[model samples]
Structures are given as C-alpha cells and as structure tokens.
Target: MDQPGLATAATQLCGISHPVFQAGMAGIACPELAAAVSETGGLGHLGALRLPPAALARQIAETRALTDRPFGINLVHRGGPAMFEHLLAIAIKARPRAISLFYGDFARVIPRIRAAGIVAMVQVGSVAEARKAVADGADMLIAQGVEAGGHLRGQVGLMALVPAVVDVAGGRPVLAAGAITDPRVVRAALALGAAGVWCGTVFAAARESNAHPAYRQRLVEADTDMPRYRRGLSYGWPWGTPHRAIPGRGGLNPWRLMGGGLRRGDKSALAGRLSLYAGQGVGQIHDSLPAAEIVARLVAGLRTGSDSPPSPQGQEA
Candidate 1:
C-alpha cells in the first residue's frame, strides 16, 4: 500500500511529515518511545506528569539526544500558576518543538509558550474549553472524546466532541484524541474535520515503550475488558482523576484491585498495582512491534481504507 496522505496545519507548523501526534501517556510513554515515533515522521511527546524539575530536564535531554526530529512535552496542568510556571520553565529550558497543555488555566500558560517561540497545543473535551483555549492563544487544539483512556473529566463522545471543537477552533489545527486506534477511526476523525489523530494505545504497545513485560503481554492479549478507569479513588495524587488503564495484575477483578486507591504506606509500594491504561480500542491492539514499525503500519492503514483495522486477534472485555 502507498503511504497515508495526510498533511495538516499541525504537521506543517510542527515540522512533522504526518498528522499523527502520539499522546504523552504517563509512566510508560517515555523518551525512547517518543523519539522512535518522531524518527518515523510523527510528532512525539513526553508525558511529564508529576515529574520533578530535575528528572524532567534529564528526560528532555535524553530524548533530544535520541532524535533530531521535532518532539514536545506534555504537562498536565494541575490548576495552579505555580504548577504551570514550574513545568513551563523546564520545557522552555529544554526548548522542544512544541508543548501540549491539558486541563489548566491557558490564559496563564499560553502566552509563555508562545513567547518562547514554541508551538502550543491544548487538549480539550468540550466546546467551551476549545473556545477558551483559542481565545487564550492555543496554536493547536486536540479534541478528546469520552471513550479515551486515562483520566477523563467529562462524558462527551468523540464524534460529538470533534466537530464542536473544530467549530470553536476557528481554523486552528485540531487533532482528535480518544478511542481512535483503527484506520476507520482515523478516517472518521479526518472526515470530522480533525487536522490529525492522536493515539496512545497503539504506541503504548510499541517495543520501545517502557511498559512492564507483564503490561506489554496484557496489551497483546487485551480483549474488551482490558482497561479499567479509576473513578473515585484519590491515592494522594493523580489517583482520583478517573484515569482509564489496563486491568490490574493477573486480570483480577478491577474493584478488588486498588478499590480505595493506594493503601497507606511507601506509596511506591502500590505503584505496580495501578491498571495498565489503554483506550476503549484495546482489543484492536494485538502485537508488540518496534515503534517505527507501528507508526509505518498506522500510517499505511490510515491511507489504505477505513474498513476496520486488520482483523484484531483479541477478545471482548
């Protein structure tokens, strides 16, 4: 098959060849994985959630050393100027090709990102948020739908969220994030006016990903019941955020896994207990290939046809 023919405002502005933006998933989404994708022509992003300033800087340097291709970092805004300023300083110091913001006061952060000459992309789930992001000066808007994995705040479905965000974007590049793991999903997003597609599940299974061996195995064997969103549990930090993830160890019942969040103690002791997050499209993921190979297939699949991804070798949740 021929290469997928996609070139969006996002691709041009970010200097990437394709309109594929890898989601900055916390934990497993690291420098190696990000660099691998960037090398293959897709925008790579580091998920720098809760990383201390020093560690953040180190990871940025490492990723830079890996690839000269454009790459960005994601800082999940925790609703405070201090938080924004802290992460912004680290990112600016690293000087990435772009910076993606999520759930924070854009009015306070967008200016700084722009001032630094770095492209700014904001991920939003609602039209109101999209309007606010643009008004605050977002260079790109990523429309996230309800079926997405990770910590989701609202319930707007992907189909409904994309057009609304596009309408509010006023021509700025808009990438669709959420349950978009198949070629059909990618085609649908492009059809709905999205400038590109942001994917997590597919890349999370890449060989370069830092996911634990067990976690990697789960992704390959993932059926429908793979992801389990942490709803009302706040284990002190990003816990109570209702983030979606892979089921707990041994495929145990979700609620029985970490029901009340982290059990009191060393904190890190229960770290491995968290669910391995994948989108609602988990069953579509069935292999552990190199990041470059995965990107190639995705680009090819998207360019081929929207007739459901190559027969999935997975089962239902």
Candidate 2:
C-alpha cells in the first residue's frame, strides 16, 4: 500500500511529515528509537524521566546526531517543581521542537518552555485536566486512556476519552493514547476528533528501542490479555500509580524482582524479572521490526479509508 500523506495540524505544528508519534516510554523509548521514527517522517520523543541532567543532555545530543527532524522529550512532574525545573532547563538548552509534560501541575513551567521556542505539550486523562492544560498555555494536549502502558492517568478508555478531551481542548490538537497499536486504532482516533495518535506499546517492540531482546519477543508472543495493570508494579515514582506490564518469568512479584540490587535497564537475569511495560494492544503486534517500518505501518493506517485528520497540534503522557 502507498504511504499516506498525513499533513494535519499536528504535523504542521510539530514540523513533521506525518502525524504519527512514538510515545516516550521510559526505559524502552531511547534516543536511537526516537531518531529512527523521526527519520521516517513521524515525530519521535525521547523519554527523560528520572534521567540525570548530564544523561538527559547526552541523549538529546545523541538524538540530534542521528536526525535533524523535529523531535521531542517526555518529562514527568514526579520530582516536584524544583526537579521539573531542572529537567526543563536542560531541555530548554537543547532547544528541541517540543517538550511533553505529564503527572502534575506543569502550568508554572509551560511559559518557560514556550519562551525557549519549544512547544509545550501536556498529557491529561480527563476533560477537566484537558481544560486545565489548555488554560495553562499548552500548545497541545495528549488524551491518555487507561489501556495505555506505563504510568496511566486516565480512568476512561480510548473510545470515550478522545472525544471528551477534544471537546475541551479549545481547538488545540489532541492526540489519543492507550491501546494504539494498529492501523485500525489510528483511524479510530482520527474519527474521534484526534489530530493524530501517540503510541507506546507497539513502538516498544521496535528493533531500535531499548527494550530487552526477551521483552521484545514477549510482546510479539503476547495477546491482549497478557498484560496486567496494577499499582506499584515496579519501583520508583509515587506509590499507587498504576502501570501495565506483562508478568516476568514465572510471574515473580515485581517488588521482589526490584530487590537484590537489580539496577534499571538490566538485560541479564534481572531483566527477565522486571515487568515489560506495554499496553493492551500487545496482541496486535506479531513481529519485531525497525522503528522506521513501524512508523510506516502507522502512516499507512492513516490512509486506511478516506478519513482526514483534523486541524490541531498533539502529545503523550
């Protein structure tokens, strides 16, 4: 099939060729993966959660080295305003195309991001939050549904949440997240008034991603029911935050796996025990491919029918 020419408000605002976006999933969404997606005409995002200042700077530099296309970095408000300020400062210095914020009231930092000529994208789960984000001067908004992987913010599903967010976005572009794995879901997001789609689970399995080989294989072998969402599935961050991940080998308790000095990004035996954060759409992915190919597939999905994307800008949570 011919690749779709998806030039919507999102693509226009983000200065990208297509509206497809690879979600910045922490641990798995690395610089290599982001650059590959950006190279393929989609907007790629580097995950910056919990990274030290120097590390975040290096990743930004690395992504820039790979591709000159517009890309963004995902930031969370977990570390308090002071911590967010420090991360934001590093991102501003890099001058990326956009900076996506989530998890807390980022209103205070939005102006600074925009002042640096970076697009301030906020991820929200509810209509109220969407309104707040828009009022806070966000250039765009991401509507996250509960079906999404990683730390979730929405209690509603994608089908109902997209339109609700769109209604309160006040003309800002709204990208739909959660269970966004295939072309069908992409089309649905557009139909529901989203300017584009922000995806995580599918991209996590890409060859360029930082996901472990076994984790990538598990995604290929998984079905919709394979992933389970629970509070405190892994260490770090505030307690009671829900995240979805496939159980480790033998279904060991995630907390127990986190013990024994298992460092983050472990690819050995420790890797097998850590939960593979993924969305409910795991069943739709059957193979591991390059990040460019994954972007191609989603871009093709935008042309599955005669549907056209709405005029608006976009985000991920």
Candidate 3:
C-alpha cells in the first residue's frame, strides 16, 4: 500500500491525477468550474443544494458537455424533506463519479448510490461522525473544521480534526478541509493522514466560479481577522458557527445590532452586501485565475514548495 501521506485512495476513487478536491461552494459552484478542475486532473464538484430537479439535470448535462472526466456533486442533506429523494433521482440520472452528502445520514442513501455505481462521499466534522459515516458505507470522508467558510459542525481546527477523522474512518479515505490554501497545508494534511485536501476559499476567487466580482476581489484582498458573519433570521444553523471572511467596518457586530436581517432572502444582496463567505486562506489568493490554472498552481506549489505569506490583519486580500 502507498504511504498514508501520499495520494492513494483519493486519486483512485475520483480517477483524478491529484488528490486535491475543489470544495463544493453553493451558489458559486458552476459547471464551468467543475469541468475545468476535472480537466486539470483534480476532482471538481457542483453544489446541488438549491437547484430544482430540472435545473440540476441541466447543470449536470452542461458539465458533461464541458468535460469527459469524472466530477462530483455536493448535496446538503438537511435542505428539505424531499431533498434526498430528489438528489437520489438526480444522481441516478447524472451518473456522476461521486456524490457527497453533508449534514445527514448516509445509511439509507448509500445503498441506492452504490446500486447506481456512484461513489458515496460523506462530510463530517467530528470523529464520531467519521466512524458512523464509514460504518454507514461512505466511500470517503471530508473532515471539515470550524475555520471553513460555510456552515461548519465542529469547533476543532484542521490540524487536529484531520488526524482524528482519519483514525475514526478505519481505512476509508479522508479529505481535510478548512484554512487550506497553500501547498504546505496540503502536504500537512497528507502527513496528518488525510488522502487529500478539499479547498473552498482557495478557489472561491477562481475565474470560473460564479462568485460576484466584488466577492472575488474581497477574497484577493481580505485579511485573516475579518469578522465572520452569520444571521439568525436566515437559518438557525447553530450560533457561533465561525465563518472566516473579510470583515466589514464595525465588524459583523452591526449586523447583529440590526437584529440579523433577512438580507440573504434577497438574491441581489448576495453580490456584495450580504456576508461573503471565505476562509482564513483567503490571504493566499493572489489572482482570479481559471479553475484549471488554480489546480495547476496547487500542483506546482506542492512540487516546488512555494508558500505565500499571510495577509495583514483586517485586510481582505
């Protein structure tokens, strides 16, 4: 067997040249980005959280049209009562290389996914979740830390969570996420027992992603101490759910003072006003290159050991 630190199960499962995975960012994930990453020899992903059935089918078809390589879809399990059923139907039709589930049980869905010959990858934030996911038949596990940009499940940081999940996974592949931007972090994740690293903020500024120009600019310019923002009016996704992003003046305290407005309910607010999701790794984002370029840069960095300096506090990029 290959060394635990080296790329092994991750490459085999996704059939990609590298173990790097483009973490599926909802609203930002697009077919162009997915296909571009896949073309660059990494696993790309499409977020299927908010899409309707027909829209999901169209997105899959569009992605297929862009690249012949394998790609994955990310499904948020707690979206609605019929989410799983809708996802299962879409998975069967799309026949993707892999389907990743977050914040849900995989027991009932894993068999159906396997029956369709699709790999079932589960994202978990704790050791217990990892063990349960493996026993429930997950092909791979994503260890997400609190420093991650989006909704997170645990307070553990990546340095500790990766190894814990790896130990609990019992030989199943584990992908470490949160604050992963540089190649050194990727190497560290591998050394810590993860088969790969899933990066969301690193690619949020990618050219192919659907993030707004202002949002992309913020990622390139934001600093590490940017106050992470969240609203109670939207979805009560647990208080103190740390989201690292470029904090605005007055921090996010003003948002709280405003009683956590329903700004997310308005689509137009997503471009710049609402909380722009990002990770501490945003400091490493220097350019808004294409997905292929981003993958190539990561692969190159891993090979050459290049590391970008951390950004100043309170800055965005």
Evaluate all candidate structures by whole-model CA lDDT and list the values in order: 0.76, 0.80, 0.73
> TM-score ranking from best to worst?
2, 1, 3
- TM-score for model 3? 0.85
Model 3 lDDT, residue 307, Cα: 56
lDDT of 1 by residue, 217-274 (tens): 6667777665766675533245556666664554555533443222113244333566
- Encode model 2's per-residue lDDT on 51-101: one tens digit a residue: 887889999999999998899999987666677678888998899998998
lDDT of 2 at 142: 95
lDDT of 3 at 115: 83
TM-score of each: 0.86, 0.90, 0.85
Worst 10 residues of 3 by lDDT: 256-265
Q: Encode model 3's per-residue lDDT on 16-135: one tens digit a residue.
A: 787889987776788888888888788889978777778888889999999999999988775576865886688667889988888777788888887888888888888888888888
Q: lDDT score of model 2?
A: 0.80
lDDT of 3 at 9: 89
The Cα error of candidate 2 at residue 193, in Å, is 0.7
| Candidate 1 local Cα displacement, residue 49, angstroms | 1.0
Which sections of candidate 2 miss by over 4 Å? 1-4, 251-265, 306-317
Give Cα distance to truth, residue 126, candidate 1, Å. 1.1
